[model samples]
Target chain A: MSKPAIAIDMGGTRIKIGIVKDNVILVSASIDADSGNGLRNRLPDIEKIVKDLMNGQKLTPEDIAGLGIASPGIIDTNEKKILSIDKKFGDAPEIDMEEWCQQAFGLSFCIENDARAALLGEWKYGKAKNYDNAVLMTLGTGVGSAAVMEGHLLRGKHFTAGILGGHFIINYKGETCNCGNKGCVETEASTWKLPSIAKEYSSFSDTKIAHVSPIDYELIFKLAGEGDFAAMEIRDQSLQAWAACAINLIHAYDPEILVLTGGIMASSSYIIPYIRQQVENHAWTPWGKVKIEEAEFPASAALYGMAYLVNSVG
Target chain B: MSKPAIAIDMGGTRIKIGIVKDNVILVSASIDADSGNGLRNRLPDIEKIVKDLMNGQKLTPEDIAGLGIASPGIIDTNEKKILSIDKKFGDAPEIDMEEWCQQAFGLSFCIENDARAALLGEWKYGKAKNYDNAVLMTLGTGVGSAAVMEGHLLRGKHFTAGILGGHFIINYKGETCNCGNKGCVETEASTWKLPSIAKEYSSFSDTKIAHVSPIDYELIFKLAGEGDFAAMEIRDQSLQAWAACAINLIHAYDPEILVLTGGIMASSSYIIPYIRQQVENHAWTPWGKVKIEEAEFPASAALYGMAYLVNSVG
Candidate 1:
């Protein structure tokens, strides 16, 4: 009664392909993106992986409804194309996804920004299913966000409405962001920028954080738990930045629920309560307090979202 | 034939009331709000002003569709009630406006936040009429904003969505806002806080600005024109704050046009160009440039908006 769909969640380091039906992934496969080769060069590998997954699941093109892709960068959902390519997939915009879908599987296709697709996935089958108005913020190398206002995905004039939450300036005089803005939340506390932010502290050389190679939130949280002063300070500052970002997003989109996702959420025991407390104290929601919660799916959210999207469109 | 509607724009200092029909104000009247006397105490005066204006215009309740009041607080448009009271009108939330309207005259009534009403007025008859997605920022004592996205007013779950644009934190480590946030646009650039902001500067005592009894944007702009360094510095900072505010709004609401209004626009020559340049350089709008324009009607926009609202809901 339900048709299977080919779902792909394309990220910076890995490509996840799956055959999904009835909100379940029948068979999934993944490969190193080797993004240095560019998305254009990886087409053949992606085709092979999808075919192998379908064959392993005993599925054919006729058994599938369509294909859905969740990708980084600005996605033109109507065109089923990636409009703007970020560092991970420099050649993504040049790829004809619809043509590829047609040739590889004789299937129609749909696409959405990875963050938006994740939010959609959450809304359809995850934590945000109960909320009509919700926002999803994924904290990792960069902050990625999506807003669903009154149950509709906020795709603005340029299709960048809900996805650019990371770029909202939390501190106008703070630091320069890659997006050509100063003091963006991502620039202030994201994984890629955290090292520099931590290094700029007053006594960085004396702190244990200064000696740690490949700096990340996990190491910082661990050091902070061990009563390292500098680590504690940076952790608090990062939390404050994230809290400010959540408040900013809350003010911007006016969502009833905020879904916190991505790698940083692995520290949910410390992160969730801190952000919730900060937002509860600061955000001006007269009607009621916004519910802050961890995302239901951590890794395969966008994959499920892609399947959901394909099914919805089909 | 169009029916007349009694429209009111209630503010801290003045109450603007008008008899409007077909988007035009037929006869208008005003009275001091005497806000110290409380909104409940001034209800009779408001009723008298409305009655006198209607009588002078040779109109009666039978000839009018309904009454529309735009007030400076969280307004429950559904119940025609003011839900939240600010400092200026402490008694607003307690007053049953629907009951008062029924007692004053046998007429239906509706209400909306003043800024939202102004935006609607602009959307219906002023500069923003050409664009479906637009944002309006009124900068003076405080920064007020309203957004129309895809031709619909953004009233969030709490009725605070578009109205809280001023409270969006531009600097997380900047200043403590009354709304419990740090470095809100209002906290940085509003008229009420400008003097304190100026006083915090290094050379404030030596500058010509220190001699000015009441430091305001008008005096600051004039002194900046006359080449006063302190005034120029403060003015530049203010413009930066405002520019950051505009970009924040642009990122948040995704508008096609940003309408600058309020008393501070008196320095439009310097203010507009500075903000436009900053936003053009910093904002990440990939579709095209958001048209920055001045509001067509500053004083009577809310009155017209109230009339439009009354007519639509009558």
Candidate 2:
């Protein structure tokens, strides 16, 4: 007899909105996002989307118990504020999420970093069920990650401990990231860096992917499967970075299960086995092997977790 | 009044024994450690030494509530046993420390890794007195470290999270460590690795200390202070490695204070300032500056922590 909650996963290209109850999504929909204009300028658009979602569902502000929003950035959920900005967020921190939720839906609201909320979702209902210690890494444009250790999200002395796993320096002098670090794993393998990394392959001069405007991991895997030498080389290199990042995560977080989410995992067939081999060979876990798996419910996951979060808080 | 605890810090070179009551060391003493042979062969010697210390004070086993030991290696404190042998402990896990205490003093025992015990001691009574989150690192023969994040010790999913900060790879292809990792901070800055690292320094052929028996951070710092070109180069490089590791630790464990302890910090006069500078300059903490300090008691810190372990567990 607890009240239902509205879960929102706000992303760059699209925002996923869902009404969840008892860990199930009752109604869900995706709306186009006006992200290129920057998160700072998209306030009215985002407000409209949330209001429309609630109106379309025929739910009044009093009907829902609370609202949960997952956004891309450094979020100190305690403050309910977006802390940092990156490629995905052009206008953030300025967007008063709490006020918007109060004015539009007349509900109490909670917000957390997208990766962290996804981890919460997985821990409550998805691949991480029954796991007290785990990490979920979303390998998309940038390597997004969060960790749960000893039955709690690993928010550290300043709530930044577990979320910065992607900024881990895998190569000391490899590549530059806008985070002011050099040779971070994300700077070498993530979708944001994939095009430049692909260009370094010997076959980049002749591959079919060269024709694509925004080349990515998907195209690399597909082209490699078609026997493109350069594509295979870069693909293997990217796999190494991801696998190394996984090993680093295993070392740092000591989580039992590392769940891979995000768009790049759509090519799970190629990435999974390759990364698994590297982990077995390189990771320094003396106790036993860490379980590596893929996420199942993904974009709707934070919504599902929202259902349980409100109850737990109460 | 709280019951008094007997704390012992066991090292390859020395043993420090202290009687602690409510976080204050009432009395303490030290004796040469048995390191010419394996540590397993020296337990009886260790026990006899502790007995002598107590006898000098005219105290009996019945007066002590429990014994706490800080040894150098992996520890299974819950079971009151050492788990493995590192450089100092050739055969430690084979020894039954808890049984030894029971037979000799008719008392229970608690044991922990030296690095972890030091952090615990600091958290409870030393520099990190009021801080609930902290990471303490000892830059001795190899970098030894432990972390407390958000008021909890990060034992991780594998019981290796905070204790293995030295093994964190700063450069995946940088250098090799005995733990099977490459470019770890320890492999670059620790005393045990300094000889080989110094050899590659340009001044190695001409430095005054190169003619000495063992080339270590001690000689490097000494010579660097005296204007040896090669020694200064090696010293600065190693400092940079350690500084990077500190920033990495800040991001990984998210501790409010980072404590530098152990042998290399014998010249903390130089290492402390540089680390604080680098952290302030490079570390991505928007909250504020991460405080850096030297271990207050240094050599006797783990012994102080041993008392804490005994009291908390026994």
**lDDT at position A76, candidate 2:** 72
User: Candidate 2: deviation at residue A110, Å?
Assistant: 0.9
Model 2, span B186-208: residue lDDT tens: 77778878778877766567778
Residue A77 accuracy (lDDT) in model 2: 74
Best by DockQ: 1
**What TM-score would each prediction reach against the true structure?**
0.97, 0.92
Report the error of model 1 at residue A61, Å. 1.1
| lDDT by residue for model 2 (A1-314), tens | 76777887888678887778867776777767676777656556656766776788887767777888888877777878887757566667777878877776677878877888888889988899899889888888788888998888777766687887778777654666867766677887898888888777676668787788789788888888999888888888788788877877777788889898888998998787877776777667766778888887766777776666755663
Regions more than 4 Å wrong, model 1? none
lDDT of 1 by residue, A136-254 (tens): 99998789999999878888766878888888888877777888888888888989898998888898899999888999999989999999998899899889888988998898888
Each prediction's fraction of true contacts recovered:
0.53, 0.55
